[model samples]
Target: MADPTPLSVFDDLRAESDELDDAVAELGPERWALQTPASGWTVAHQIAHLAWTDHSALLAVTDEDGFRELVEKALAAPDSFVDEGAEEGARMPPAELLARWREGRTALDQALRAAPPGARIPWYGPPMSAASMATARLMETWAHGLDVADALGVTRPPTDRLRHIARLGFRTRDFAHVVHQVPVPADPFRVELAGPSGELWVFGPEDAPQRVTGPALDFCLLVTQRANRADLALRAEGPDADRWLDIAQAFAGPPGTGRPAKGDAR
Candidate 1:
């Protein structure tokens, strides 16, 4: 699949955020306090993290120096910086947190839109284009939105927006292995997924010996570490591809302790 235009990605990012907002707009304080699957994180923390990241992204786009400060703080406490941001935001009243998220995301949108043509944005990972930054934001909003839904005992119907995530998961195939300290695959793997709307999404050459095929929802969940592999319907046709399924992570940073199968004790 071709890379989506930054404009389209920014639009989708807004829609994804709006959808998550609708899900929690009416939530009571008590519900916000409920813990999600992420350890030590409540439903509020999920939203807080999104808001915090959006703010950081804004800084990255419009104020590189400020963004670097955040980088220094993160480097100073690699293990605690993420949780620290989430924890600080999660401590606010539900109303305040929601307002901050909405406001911060709007500012980020404006900053990204105004970024000079051909300019690369500083990020936690390697510098990338504005479109890539937007895609990363969309990916995270959707993933954390899942945790919020689970906490609320509601199911978010799958949507074509997952295509962005599916593509990311495919492109990050090698990064996944490298992060795990495993050898990066010397050759690309072919990946085929059936999108939520029944569209075919194919990546890599058809003749590639390694292949992964599955429902797009399952692939996104696996790559995001939102669900256990044993619980997903994804199938792999090569040894390396199979191993990739075991450790595939679309996001940067340390690999997560993914969810356990339904049959396993938590």
Candidate 2:
């Protein structure tokens, strides 16, 4: 299947970042420190991490030395870097964090816009073109924003713009294959996504028989392991369908242990 258009993905990244900024801005100080659904991070830490990450991502994309330096900085930061950053963040309040986040994001955006078409940039994993880097950032912000929302018992208004994040799920098939030590599937299967607004996104050949379908938010949560697939309405059809669902991953790096079983939520 053809890859997503670069401009579309870039637009999604900007929009998702802006939405997350708004959500963070709305939280009171006490709520910012509340523990999130993510195992080890609090709401404040999640926001701080976004700031730290965006800065790091920009360095990684622009200057090789700067990328290495940031990694060294992360290694040297206190064990509670997130907490420390959050503590510092609290002093400035949400408005400040939102400002910092936007400034860092703007720098990255400028760099991305300035890069020549097809120019490759260094990333934490494999090098990616500017377009891919922006898409990755979009996925990261959206996933982490979910953590913050879950902690506060707030639900983010789902947007069709998140199709970019959903598209990443399809691209990460290779990551899943490697994590499972299985050969990549040569025959493409149909991926039918039901967005939060009831919009459908179809990937792969029109005639491909296999199908995966569910609410876009649920699919994102499942793939990101923020929620269990059983909690979602997702379903698979066709011979190899179950297996694909079993190992689907939408991000770079290793496979996560799937979420606890349906009855085990605690």
Number of the top TM-score candidate: 1
Clashing pairs in 1: none
**Distance from true location, Cα of 242 in model 1, Å:** 0.6
- Error in Å for residue 177 of model 1: 0.9
List ranges where model 2 is wrong by over 4 Å.
Answer: 1-4, 69-97
Tens digits of per-residue lDDT for model 1, 131-235: 788888999999999999999999999998899888989989888998899998888899999998888899999999999999999999999999999999999
Off by over 4 Å in 1: 1-3
The local distance difference test score of model 2 is 0.76
Clashing residue pair totals per candidate (backbone < 3 A): 0, 0
Candidate 2 structure quality by residue, lDDT tens digits, 48-148: 77787788778876788988876565568735544565566545666677788889999998888788987888765678988888888888888889888
Error of 1 at 124 (Å): 1.5
